[model samples]
Target chain A: MKKLTKDDLQAIKQEELKKETANWIKVGLSTCGIAAGAQDIYDFLVEEVKKRNLGVSIQRCGCAGMCYAEPLIEVKVEGMPKVFYGKVNKETAMKIVEKHIGGKILVNDHIYDIRSSQ
Target chain B: MQQKRILIKDTDLKKDRTRDFYTAFLTEIQDKKLEEKVQLVRVSDIGIYGKGLTVRVLPENFLYCDVETGDISRIVSESVVEGRPIEALLHKPDDKQLRLVLRNCGLVDPESIDDYIKHDGYQAIATILEKMTPEKVIEEMKISELRGRGGAGFPTWLKWKLTRAVEADQKYVICNGDEGDPGAYMDRSVLEGDPHSVIEGMMIAAYVIGATKGFFYIRAEYPLAIERVNRAVTQAHEYGLLGENILGSSFKLDIEIRLGAGAFVCGEETALISSVEGKRGYPRPRPPYPSVKGLWGKPTVINNVETLANIPLIMLKGGKWFSSIGTEKSKGSKVFALTGKVKNSGLIEVPMGTTLKEIVFEIGGGGIAGKKVKAVQTGGPSGGVIPEDFINAPVGYESLQKLGSIMGSGGMIVMNEDDCMVDIAKFYLRFCVDESCGKCAPCRIGGTQLLHLLEKISEGKGEIEDLDRLRRISRAMQKAALCGLGQTAPNPVLSTLRYFEDEYKAHIVEKKCPAGRCAGLFHFSIIEEKCKRCGLCFRNCPVQAVSGNRDQGYLIFEEKCINCGRCFEVCKFEAVSRG
Candidate 1:
C-alpha cells in the first residue's frame, strides 16, 4: 500500500462505504469472548458457511460489555431484525444458522440482546 | 407483511415469573387470535431489575414494567394490536449508559484499518492536521473539558499546555497502558478492541503539545493488547499518519512501544517515565512533574490509555459536544472494567453522573449467584468501597472522592454479602505492599503496618485499638507517600474501616467472620443429618482430615485441618457447615 495523503483517506473511506454487504455475522473475538470459546464458534461458523455456500459474511469484533453472555454472535439478515445471541457453542451456532439465517426466525433461549444498528 | 415482537423477562428477585407471565401472555394472545401478529420472546436479560415481570413491545418501543396477568390483554390490544401504549402500564426507562468513547468498541473489526476508517477513524487526525493549529487544538481540548481518565482526573488541556509552555529541546508523549489493577482490564480491552483510536489520540496529542516522539508504556501481561498496538502503529506509519511530515503537513511525529516489567508502581506517571527511560521503576518526588521534567530530562506528557482513547472522538465531534456528556466537574464518558460478583462483568462506558445502582443492576444485570450486593469497590486498591446503601449516589470524580474514593482508572468491582470488608481491604493492601518500591518511609512502613493490622483483624486476633492504628498509618501514608500508588494504597483500608467498622468489631469482640470468608475465624464441621456418607469429604481432604467409611459416616478432624476449606468444597451434600 502506498503512503496515504489526505485525498487518499477520503477515497478509501468512500470505497469502503460503497462495498456491497447484504448479510453478515459478527462474533465478539475480544479476550472475554475468546476465553468463552469464541474461536471454536468462529471456526465452526466459517466452516459451515463455506460448506453450505451461504451468502453471509463472518467478521470478528471486540467485547460489547456483556461478559455474562460470552461467545456473543450478532447476526444480520436482509429482512429480519439484527439479533445478538450469547453463550454460543457449535450446536447453538448451527441452530443460529438454520433458524436465524435460513428459516428467518430468531433463536429462542440464546438471545441476550436485540437491537438494530441499521 | 406485519411483524411485531415482545421481549419479556422477570426482574423480580423473589421468584422467576418470566415463564408464568410468558404462558399467560401467550394464552391471551391466542385468545385474541393475534398469535401471527405478535411474536413473544423470553429474553434472558431485559436490562431492567426489580420491576417484576417486564414487557417490552418492539418497533413501537413501548415498555411495560411490573406487568400482571391482567395487563397482558391490554398490552396485546393497546401496544401489540393497536400499535399504541396503555397509560396504566407504560414505563419510561431512564437509560443511564451513553456510549461515546466506546462507540466503535464492539461494532468494528478491530484488526482492519479500513473497517475503522469506515466508522470515521483517522478522520479526526486527518482534519486536525489539515485545518487546526497547535493553539487551536489545545483550545478545543480545553473547551471539551476532558479530564484524565487515569484516576486523578487531571485536566488534559492543562497537562498539554504545561508541556507546551516549557521550551525544551525535545518533547515526548506517552500513552500509559500499564493497567495493573487486580480486577481492571479496561485499558487492555480498549487497546485490543480499538488500538487505532489510541494511536490517533496520541497523534492529536502530539500535534497539540508539539511532541515529535511518543511511546506506549503497556504492561507485558497484555500480550494481545501489545500486539494490536504494535500493529496499529505500523498501520498508521504505512498510512503516512505517523512518520515525518504526517498527512502532507510540516509537523512530524513518531511513536514507539515500550513493555512494562509488570510493576504496579509504573502505572504512576513519574514511575512510568523512569521505566520508559530504561531505569528501575521507582517514583521520585514531584515538584518538577513529568510534564515539566520527564523521559531523560526532557518535557513529556503522559496520558492514560482511556484518556488518549477519548481524543479522536473529542476532536471529531468538537470539544463542546464532548463536554456535554458528563457531570459538572467530570466531562465525557468513562469506561469501567466492571468485574467481581457482577453478573455482566465486562467493560461498561457510561456518562459521569450515572448512579452506582444503574451501572451495577441495569448494565451489570445485577449480582451473580443470587447473592445480595454488599458494596461496589471502585479504583482498585487506591479506591474506597461504596456501601450498598450509597449505591444510588452519582459517579463522578469529585463525588467518588467525597465518598473516600477516587475514580481510579475505572476499575469497579461489585462486591457481595459474602465478601468480608476486612478481607477485601486486606487483599488490596497486600497488592500495594508487594508493589511498593520502598522509596519513602510512610508508604513502605505504613502499607506494611496497615496490611498487618488487616491480617490481624481477619484472623480474629484484632483489638479495637488496631482499628485506630490503621487509621493513623493510613493518614500518614496518604500525606507522605512519594507517588500516587503509595498515596492511594490506604484508601481501601480507610474506606472499609469507615463503612464496615461493625464487621471489624464483630471480628474483634466476637471472634467471628460474619461473611465466613476468614477461615481462621470460622470453623467448619459436618452436619450429621445433612451428611450423605458419600465419602467425598474423606477422599478430597488435602490434609487427610476427613475420616471414616461411607456406612460409618465421615468426620472432619479439626486438629489436622489447616482451614483451607477443601472438604467443604468437595461435600456433595450440604453437610459442611461453617459459622
Candidate 2:
C-alpha cells in the first residue's frame, strides 16, 4: 500500500489487467441490485463454485442500470458469449453454473441483455 | 463447424409469441439437424420494441425484425445455418444512446481503485498535475461547454472561474451529491457504482481552483453510496491523490464527507453550503453566490455528481472532442434515471439533446404494460412535465426549458395515459410543500396556497377562478420566494396548466376527471355484460359496496362506492368500470 506516483499507475493497471487467469462472474452488488436479491445469487454462485471445485471466480460490481431484471449477473465463461442474466435467483444461479459454465451452452429465457455495445 | 447463435424475442406488447416462435425455430433447426452447431436462445428482451418479432443472429451481428413463421426457415438457413444474412429482412436499428459519464459505472467495481485505474480513472488528475495550468483547466471546461447537470444548467467552467478569480487563501470545493428530487437516483447510482471517477473529477476541480479542502455532500439516505465514497476517499488519500502533495505535485488537497440530513432544499447550492457548515438547510438570496463566498466565507466551487463524473473524461479526452457530441448549447452526454411506467426502468445515458421520444421508446423500450405514454415528467418537483406531443423536443437545458421543463437532475419519469395531469401537478406541489424550509412567506404561504388550490381542483370543488388564482400564486412564488425551492415549486403546476389547461377546465367546469385519477370526481359502476360474476370485484371491495354474490352477480352501489378502483384492478372480466 505505497503512495502511487504517476509512473506507477500504468504499470499497476497493466499488471491488474493481465492478472485475469480464470473465468469470472460479476454480480451487480449496488443498492438496486442488492434490493433485487443479487446478494443471494452472489453467495450461491460462490458456494456452488467452491462445492463443485470450479475454476470460476465470483466478484461484485455495481448496477448496470437495467434494474427491472435484477438480481442481475454477468457470466464470462470461456468460449461463451458474455451476457447478462436478469431476474436471477438461486435456481437460475445453479442453472447458469451447470449450463453456461459446465455445459458451454447459454441457458434459455434467462438472458436479459447481451453486451452488444462492447 | 463454426458455432452460430440466434437471439429471439417477441416485441409485441399484447401477446408473447416467443414460445410459438421458439418452437418453430427449434423445429426448423431440428429439420436441418443443426441443433448443436446452431444454438437458438429465447431472450427476455432483445432491446427492440414494437417492431413485431426480432431475431438477432450472432457472430455476424445481423438483425431481422418483423420475422413471420414462414420467414423463420429462411432466417435459419441463411443467417443461422449458412452464416449469410437475408438482405431484405436485415433491419438496421438506430441506437441513440451513448454512455460517457456512466462508462465505468456498473462495469468497474466501485470499491476497487485498481479497477477504476485500469479503466483510465485518475489519469485526468495525473495529467492535470503534470501539465495543465488552472486557467488551462478552466479553458478546457469552457470548451466542453458542460453546464451543471444539477437542474439549473449553470456552466461548470464559469463557476470555477468565478471561484478562482476570488483571491482567498482557504478555498473549498464541494461535490453536490444531495440529490433530493423524487424519482431521481442518478447521483446515488453514480456515487455507488463509480466512486473513484467522481473523486477524480473533484481532484481535477481542486487542482483547477487551487482549493486545499473539499467536501463530498451525500444525503444520509444513500448508505451504500456513503460507504463506497468513504472507501474511495480513503483509497485516494492512501495513493497520494488527496491530503497533501497529490500526485507528487506541489498542490495539496484533502477531501472529507459531510452527510445531509435528508432535506430537499440542501440540493440548492447556498443551502448545501449552509448544511455543510452544520446549519439548517435554508437557502439564502444570491448576491454572493457560492462561487464568490462559499463554505465558511471562503471562495468555493460546488459541482453536481454527474457534472463531476464528466470532468475526468473531459480532462482525459480533449474538450473539443467532448463538445462534438451534444447540441450547440448543451454538450457531452446526460444520464437519466428512467423510471415510472417505463418497461425497462433503469439508468440510461444518452448524448445531450437526444429527443425524449428516443429515450422512452428506443432506450427505455416504451411505456410499461401495454399502456400508451401520455406525458414524460422531467426535472422532478422543481421542473415541469413534457406532454406526449413535445417528447420529440431535444432534451437540453434550453430545449427542455422551452418545452416548459428543465433537465433537473436527469429524473425522467415516463407517465402513462392513466396518470392525471392535475394529479401529477398536485403530487409535485405536495412534495415541494412538505420539503419547503418555510424561510420565506411567498414560498412558505404561496406553496401551501397553490397546493390547496390544486387539492380543490382534484376534489371537484374548484371554480374557474381558482385556475387564475393558481397562476397568480405560482407567479408570486417564482418571483418573491427566497430560493430555488419556492421559485421553481410552481413549475409543475404552471407547465401542466399551460399544456393541459383543457384538462384543468374539465376538472373545474365539467366536474369530471378526464383521466379518472381523482377519486372524488369519479364513481364505480359495473357493466352487467362484462361482469362474469366471479366475485373477484366483490371480494376485493374494501367496504361492503356490492351486496350480490356469485349467483346473483355483483353490483357496485353508487352510494357505498369509495371510487378506490380496487375492484377495477381485481376484475379479470373488465366488469368493474369507473367514470
Top-scoring candidate (lDDT):
2
TM-score of chain B of each: 0.94, 0.97
Compared with the true structure, all predictions reach lDDT values of 0.87, 0.89
TM-score of chain A of each: 0.94, 0.92
Worst 10 residues of 2 chain B by lDDT: B12-21
Cα lDDT tens digits for candidate 2, B1-579: 578788888888434477788888899999999988888888887788889988988878899999899998888777776778899988998767788888887789898988888899788888888998999999999999999999888999998998888898899999999998898999998999999999889888888887989999999999999999999999888888887777788888889999999999999899999999998888888979877888998989999999999999998888999999999999899999999999999999999889999999998988877889989999999899899988889989999998888998999999988999999999999999999999999998999999999999999999999999999999988999998899999999999999999999999999999888998899988899988888888888898897798888878888888888899898898777787
Q: iRMSD per model?
A: 1.9, 2.0
Angstrom error of the Cα, residue B177, model 1: value is: 0.4
Please give, for residues B69-119, the per-residue lDDT of candidate 1 as tens digits.
888877887788788888888889876777776777788888888888888
User: Stretches of candidate 2 above 4 Å error?
Assistant: A116-118, B13-16, B557-560
Candidate 1's displacement at residue B160, Å, is: 0.3
